[model samples]
Target: MDADLLKTFLAVIRQGSFVGAAEQVGRTQSAVSQQIQRLEGLVGGPLLVRTSRAIRLTVAGERFVEYAQRLVDLADEAKRAVHGLAVQRTLRVGIVEDLAGFALAEILRRLHDEAPSLQLEIHSASTRELLPLLGFRYDVVIGMKPLASRGGVELSRLSLCWLGEWQGGPVPLALHPDGCGMRQAAIQALDAAGIDWRAAIVADGILPNIAIVRAGLAVTVLADALCPADLPRSQGLPALQPLSLRLFAHEEADRQATETLGRIISETLGAAVC
Candidate 1:
């Protein structure tokens, strides 16, 4: 039995929606749905029932939840027995919202399991903000930048695309508030191409931005990995350049814990990019 599948199931149960669970676990909603489908197949029955607004556990899921908890508890106990105990440390980690939505949960879980006493203070923001927060405010920051930019090891490079509905005339844009790398890429691409566009909905955070796009308010530039399947890529739009996610560390923090956490995050999200 895969512990990850169990955890994913529990996350869906707790979150009540795949989108919410994906954010909680740091996986795409599509990935979360696939995990649930895999778990149902393994269990030989449906575990979740999806309504228009929320997801509910089926009878099989309810029964399996208890076993899942016990299994995870036993696994944690076994790990603790082998590694002994962990020392107390407060870890301040700054992560770009894009990466956080893809693989934040598992990375944080790995760090906690590896060092039981590590208390995490997570700050999720756009790469533009997270980059500056590194060292001064955060122990480490996981951010996205143009592939051409030097500094930090590249974890993944993703192709960005315009996503949402096209209602004709002056492209309506649902953009991230000023400081986002994706926003800059979109603006630059449109300007370079001499395309006319307007910020129909200027929002902060991925969820709100996605909501605005889904409502057909405006189109936004997003990585193929993070974009939901239902949101069609807008046609006849200027091509946006690719971006690379990289890691930045502050030497002032605890080297061992920071390095370990960074390795876990990089390993978890390496495949999320194009």
Candidate 2:
């Protein structure tokens, strides 16, 4: 169908007069009338019945009007698609606090340059929390695989290790609450060796654990992917077998190529943390 005819018909309906629609569309009243006439002829039915005092749509007109509105909306969306291809509007991203050590800052920086208009909402939580929320909560999430979740798949995997202040005595350990994979791995290692240790502190967030470790408060086991640059490390093999944590991304409609995002994360981990 001719979009101009649809436009003219819609304008006439909205403005309530051909003369008014002509003005609204920047066309002569006769041109508007011609467009309407062409549209009525195509439909093979009367679209409108007009009187000097009033104008209104027929049953056919109302149905066609609905379709006309959809066509106009599609046209507008087509225009927006060009701009959207260049930059997404807002990307909702969520990651567990642990993975933030390596991948968090990297993806954020690349998104800034490649999609400047994108509004990133970063949510940090546990792997268990982050995984299921990917169904509706976020566009991307980087964290350990959730045990029961079948939604997201791994982007990459890295070894987990126990690191602490070398000078710190007997390595008073700080740990997050139980049920966490990291904590489970650490304790299993300690138990098998029959190692004696003291629990000096417990923190809810990974950042706090990092802070405590950096401040020499206590030692903690963390993913090798997260060794930060600012804190110096002692050169030695981890006491326990290294664990592996897989980074995952949300999978749903319109999942895009994540190479750029992956590279940013890998490079950032390389620079800021080992």
Candidate 3:
């Protein structure tokens, strides 16, 4: 069995469509369909039942999933064993600014402990800025969900909270510049509630927004875990929805390394909330 075909098959399972799998695998939809056909031929049976709405795996496909994953994992492990020491593989990671604080610290610490040989290049930006670079500049991206339409694994969901002192008038908000998920959420929530708001400080990153909030200039929305203990969660404002943290990986990225990083991030954030 070809490992590449197995990988494509796994991507199809994960993405739930041939078009999505094609994007992940850097192949055309027709190519992905042909790969699946070829794989089915090799396995001597049909693996997937494709309908107009979704793809369903056959019993044979269900049975093949485990072995296929194991074979791919072993292949990846073998490659790492052969070239890890001699070739310093660089893993480029992109993350939202909100997690660039303690959550990121813990993630990096665990990643270093687990995959010490990996050379990492980390970029922290707004989710809007990071998603476009997923397969191009970044091997993996940790971003806020509902922003991406498809193709990311959910890591955790953090409740959004209003952080800072409430001044009691049209709410003064220190929000990120446009293209931020939180910013969009905040504005929509405020508008839907008929609450008047003024963007007191429009910054590109979280730190600047935090600085403004700390100075008592404006209130901002943040994940409950990211809010400072000293900052009060203002009441009487409309409740905000929880933001889902998601991990997106390039199809050709080192699978084990990306999975390890995703697990560490999920655990670190989960522990923080707990």
Give the candidate number with the greatest TM-score. 3
Estimate the TM-score of every prediction.
Answer: 0.61, 0.57, 0.65
Error of 2 at 166 (Å): 4.7
Once superposed on the true structure, which residue ranges of model 1 sit more than 4 Å away at CA? 1-86, 113-117
Task: Write one digit per residue (lDDT tens) for candidate 2, span 1-274.
Answer: 8777888999999999999999999999999888898999999998999988989999999888899889988887887998776666555667768666555665687757765665667788877677677758777766654344354443445556766665533557778776667777667776776665677678777888888888877778777766675665533424544433444555552344343455556555553331
Selected candidate, larger TM-score, 1 vs 3: 3
Model 3 lowest lDDT segment of ten: 142-151
lDDT by candidate, in order shown: 0.83, 0.69, 0.87
Which candidate should be chosen as best, given lDDT against the real structure?
3
Q: Model 2, poorest ten-residue lDDT window?
A: 235-244
Cα lDDT tens digits, model 1, 107-223, are 778887887778878888887777777787898787888878889767778789899888668888888887677888999998998888998888778888888888888899888
Write model 3 residue lDDT over 1-274, tens digit each, in one string.
Answer: 7899999999999999999999999999999999999999999999999999999999999999999999999999988888866766688999887898647777788888988888889999988899899889999998986534477998887778898888577999998887666887889899999999998999888888888888888999988887667877778888886777889999988888888888988888884442
